[model samples]
Target: MPTRRRFIKCLIALGAGLLPWSGWSEMLKIVNHQAAQAAILTNDSSAKTLDLIHPKDVSYLYHTAADDISALTASDFQGRRAGTVGEEKAAAYLIEQMKGLGLEPLGDLINKNTRNYSNAFTVYPVIEEFYNGRLTFRPGNSQDLRTPCANVIGGIMGKNKSESVILSAHFDHLGIFQGHLYPGANDNASGVGCILDLVRQLVQEGVKPKCNIVLAFWSAEEMGFVGSFSFLQNPTFSLGGLKAVFNVDTIGNGALNDFSVWASSDNEAVQAIQSAASEHNISIPLASHEGYNSDQVYFNLDHLPAVTLMARDWLNKNHTPDDVPDFVNPEKVALANKILYKAVKKIAY
Candidate 1:
């Protein structure tokens, strides 16, 4: 039986030393290629031993204070408009926080002069002008509710180009529907809070990566991953150089009392991620549902390794007005973040 400590040690040995990005990339290719061949030869038995460890032991407590903050942003807060007033404000706030945490805003610098607090993809311009400034399911109804939205982007550059990791989540929620303010507590505010805390952790440790860490707070994801899709088209860094992306969306209220990770089928990075989770006794249920639905869709299409993380199997509250705070389990959310942090460090560093 492979113990957790030995598992981590194996990963560390895979890198040997984390100083060069090319070396790490090369190592990843070799290990993943071997794993792939092994899978083909053996009939996918790798999962047999991997899934035995229980996921409950590694779960972390959801911080009450963090939950409160997420509640205010996703559910309790006012409107967020994409490329407009409210969303711009939210984007600015996120950038300020990132700057305060010692991370340089890489997206803006990459985009150059047009760089504002927020990063704009071309789709937002069309949505704001043609769609009449609302993220809607209805095509031609005035009664369609409007969502406040914004896309916040920031990054800490890695040691070099070949190795990069993206940490992303959507912060925008349904603004107003049927004269009631929709508090999207679990719908996505939880994801935003988790990303923010992850940023803080990276800053606190001052642990720079061998590849860059890009943090994005997408806007209008509910409106079809508009913000993220746009960013993907005009990414700050080349998509080919991207190592992996972790997309956290709607990470609240799971009926199963646990969460799962959905990894794209073409990605080889999933093995390393699974190995990392196994070290912590966390179970990541894998899937390959591709609809370009979330921010991860762009990354997936770009042929990069990517995965979406969220509390699994939540019913009913997906896009309704009832998706408010109190129902969310912050303990579950924090546990997800811890797993995310470990997965990120293992892959990026």
Candidate 2:
């Protein structure tokens, strides 16, 4: 595979042709290029192997959750807005984490020599306005308003590769608006952190699932679910083979022991989640909704079985500068991690 620097340079070159904002594109190209090079030089050489001893205790879980959230909410990521340098940097970070976990790359497999974990896609301008905090899509195509984005994907292959289960979290948030940063800690960093720790525990314990377990970190979710919509339109794997999709979002900053789950329908996926919560002694309140929010929307629209887990006050710090890591509850995040881990295991194993 090409070095990270070379890969980003290629992406920047390709993006220049598609984007009309020459000044913005040029600035990002320079920033991303330098950042990618710096990352390569300082990259850790040690692989995250099972041989490395770790105390799999409650404290460790809290530490891991805090670490992941802090990293994502760091100022260097600049809010991780879609189609921006910050989002690209976050994607690069996820790629490294997935690599460390020994996951198989399931995106950009066309070029064997440069296979990567990025499923690059374009987000066309469609929304006319945000009426009552809800987006209304425009009818006609506006090619000039297209934005570039990508989804980070990795997976653990199981004995039955023909079937798969997906655990997803969107890493994108509203970028700096009006000169203030919306750090997106509880909005989504919590979800990403929870999934990362969950997978880490699974790998460390050597649990071999029956169906492939895909870890998908979606981009452009704040942009009306464009990344996931694109994935559904042109998936890297066979969508028909997907047994279930469990999406985690905003699982921090709420009541310490309170959580909510909404499903596409009353199906096996929902049953699996309920069973996992019951077995693991986790409290997850099951509820019913239209499933129009979060990354699960596209899958639900396709009539595919999906569910979303949430544990945050939507009107509190969401999309605001106050949404910083300080507000995130590590205990709550760890609880979410445990719930998702057990739920996915029940379905995949």
Candidate 3:
């Protein structure tokens, strides 16, 4: 591992290739570090905060995912189904990104170079098809097909390692169906994008958490949360050691600047997130309800702290070919990224 100074310098060395303007290079420096050691919340319930994290930092923390979504949802991805060529491409890209960002390997994995950064498993996909708004699983015979899948994991170590906050998003989506490709840009590509961008910031900005922050890109989620559930069953770290789980899914659409964090009303993570969202003035709403569609369901079922931020118009072109990149709002995607980052900081910092 590089020294903290070298890691910070790596941010600068990432260089001008991705910057919209080369002159903005100076702006990317860590000019403000007040938020680094803040308590993350105030004594007063209404006064939570993450100080001096400028607005453009959201773009810096978010654009990569947007750019990644474009790549991940492109023709190369073929909708990113588990055990397929498209899914393998997506996993390779995630491993490459994790390596580039200098995150530590959490545990063992099928690929030695990837370490725990890539966990491959044999998952039974729960294929669903909808007709006239009625959803049904594919036939019994089809259910017998078990395929090898991969999940990408990485994290930032904090001062306290006994417990950690998890930031997750599934990278898998429905592959081609009935001869039409399902782009799955908003269904999940957007969520994975957010995870990538946040981890990138934690890596480059030298912002260490008080508790470790674990980032996971689940596989085979489209197959009924198999990836997340599998990890929960056999995680490198203990499930009991988890402080909270923040999941992002389908965050690329519905009201250009608005999003919703879905969770049960009694869940404490919701209130903490509400306070954090208020402090940051992020354009996000908390929708208190149990959601069975996304990966948060398993955590919620186990009575663990879990919440997911997703686009309100998640049904728009969802699981279909129309969930393409040109339709996503970069600004809105950036806002969701900001809210998730802030929420994670509130919990771990």
lDDT of each: 0.61, 0.75, 0.71
For candidate 3, the lDDT comes to: 0.71
Local accuracy of candidate 3 as per-residue lDDT tens digits, 129-236:
785553334533554877788788877777778888888899987777677778788878888887788776765555567887888888988777888888877887
On TM-score, the candidate that comes out on top is 3
Instruction: Provide the lowest-lDDT 10-residue window in model 1.
Output: 53-62
User: Which 10 successive residues of model 3 have the least lDDT summed?
Assistant: 30-39
How would you encode candidate 1's per-residue C-alpha lDDT over 212-311 as one tens digit per residue?
Answer: 7888888877666777877776776566677788888777677533666665564655665566667777666675455435677767777778777777
Clashes of each: 8, 0, 0
Segments of candidate 1 deviating more than 4 angstroms: 1-68, 71-76, 79-84, 109-117, 122-150, 255-257, 288-292
How close to the true structure is residue 248 of candidate 3, measured as C-alpha lDDT? 88
Residue runs of model 2 more than 4 Å from their true location after superposition: 1-63, 112-114, 125-141, 280-292
Superposed on all Cα atoms, the candidates' RMSDs to the truth, in angstroms, are: 13.7, 14.2, 7.8
Regions more than 4 Å wrong, model 3: 1-63, 107-114, 125-128, 133-145, 280-292
239 in model 1: Cα distance from truth in Å?
2.6
TM-score head-to-head 2 vs 3, winner: 3
